[model samples]
Target: MDEKGGAIMLEELAFEIAKAAHAGQTDKAGLDYILHPLQVAAEMTTDEEKAVALLHDIIEDTDMTANELLAQGLPDNVVEAVEALTKKHNQNYAAYLAGVKKNRLATAVKLADLKHNSDLSRLEKITQKDRERAEKYRKAIEYLSK
Candidate 1:
């Protein structure tokens, strides 16, 4: 566990950016935002995984890009984990998903995030369009998991 784990991470500037970027999301399926990453980190049984959860969305969603973070000395692997979880806007989603399935860090983080999102839609209460969008991501996750 990190010396200040939850508190330190949540208070970090980058984490704050992610929090606000996803602020409107409540994960109504009863899973708390914090719990989602905690579960992913728990899957690896490591402190960094937990911390990674707090940061997975930082780069992709915030103004603080991955290069900037690396320059700040956040460590290569940590930066990799966050990047692994990020959605690539320009690349082929199919190829990206394929790449993730073969590597544990990217695969694990993506699956954990996907699984958490999937579990929340149990009742499946959303607009058809929204459901369709979620289904695409779900299919991608399922394909990667296999």
Candidate 2:
């Protein structure tokens, strides 16, 4: 566990954060929002990606700041990847989504996550526009992952 190149216990952390952030949140299909992050983490193959999965939405939706997350003892790379995926202050939602599409690590998680959300869950609770947005995100995920 103390190996220099080792990945830490990450899946559990990711799932915990997902559960907390998505608490009481249900998709249009009546599924819990926590499932989205879990699905994203499930797609990851590395510890770094797993850590990023756990924290992907924390900064955007919660009170957690990037600096605070950095102070929580996570590796710098994981923090960077998550920050790259996060949408910061921007007036254009489409542009913000476009930015995320260009990040490899974030796009990977986002693709898999959105795929599960829109495909598996059928977006039962989301609006038509939101569904369209999810579709756009899915397409971006595909392009980015490629």
Candidate 3:
């Protein structure tokens, strides 16, 4: 397949995997969780980046494994980026962000994810916790930006 066709296929598979993985899940704002990935994917400029964006939360949030994603015909780059984006058990958020920063694709997707998550308008009501979380995201963004 041509590169374009290949990218489309990867993106489609990532979308399906992410949707199924997040089935019945809702974000803090009570919106369907898949919307978050879709929003992040929309901001990405390349197909690989879009696929990574779509699947970023799969390993961390769902039972889906990176090997399973790889076995399904997704490219190594996409799987690796998703893996980099996944936060491991007991992993410090700063350390996780540092790992994410090591992968260019993951870094782009994470920045988009953080920006989307930082949007206060997404929440019906803002709280002190929400503000604090947003501040953390801001710092992550700053760190990743550097």
Candidate 4:
């Protein structure tokens, strides 16, 4: 297979892993969890960025680890971007978002994630936790845009 073919295959594998990891899960709005990543990936401008977006929540929400992502043959840059997007358990949201902003590709993927996550209409169905998250995303956007 050619280089492009390999990238396409890697991307397919990322989608499969993400889909399975998020299976049976639903967003706060009661939508499939996979929909969130897919939406974020759709807004990306590059294949690598899309792959990072797809796997953004994998390490955070699933049993998958960063080493597993590297073993999957994803490029180092993609793995790094995904890692930046994954929030650590005890990390402050602002600090995490600031780190993401340091990487251009990660920033783009994160902005897409924030855009979907902070959608105004979804506020109607959001819980207190979701409201707080939305506010965090809003503040992060402001910080990143500066």
Query: Which candidate ranks first by TM-score, i.e. highest?
Result: 3
Task: Give the Cα error of residue 4 in candidate 1, in Å.
Answer: 10
TM-score of candidate 1 to 2 decimals: 0.64
RMSD, candidate 3, Å: 2.6
Residue pairs in clash, model 1 = none
Q: Tell me model 3's lDDT, rounded to 2 decimals.
A: 0.93
- Top-lDDT structure, candidate number: 3
Better of 2 and 4 by TM-score: 4
Weakest lDDT window of 10 consecutive positions for candidate 3: 1-10
Candidate 1 achieves a global lDDT of 0.63
Tens-place lDDT digits, model 2, residues 8-93:
46555555555776688765566776666666787889877777886788787777777876675666777777887777776475
> For each candidate, what TM-score against the reference?
0.64, 0.72, 0.93, 0.86
Off by over 4 Å in 4: 1-7, 123-130
lDDT of every predicted structure (CA atoms): 0.63, 0.69, 0.93, 0.84
Residues 117-139 of candidate 4 have per-residue lDDT tens digits of: 89868645657877787898898
Tens digits of per-residue lDDT, candidate 1, 1-146, equal 25755444422544444465556544555544544554555565445555566667666655768887677555677677677767688978887777666656667677777766665355456667667767877997778778
Residue 97 miss distance in model 4 (angstroms): 1.6
Candidate 3 Cα misplacement greater than 4 A, ranges = 1-8
lDDT for predicted candidate 2 compared with the true structure: 0.69
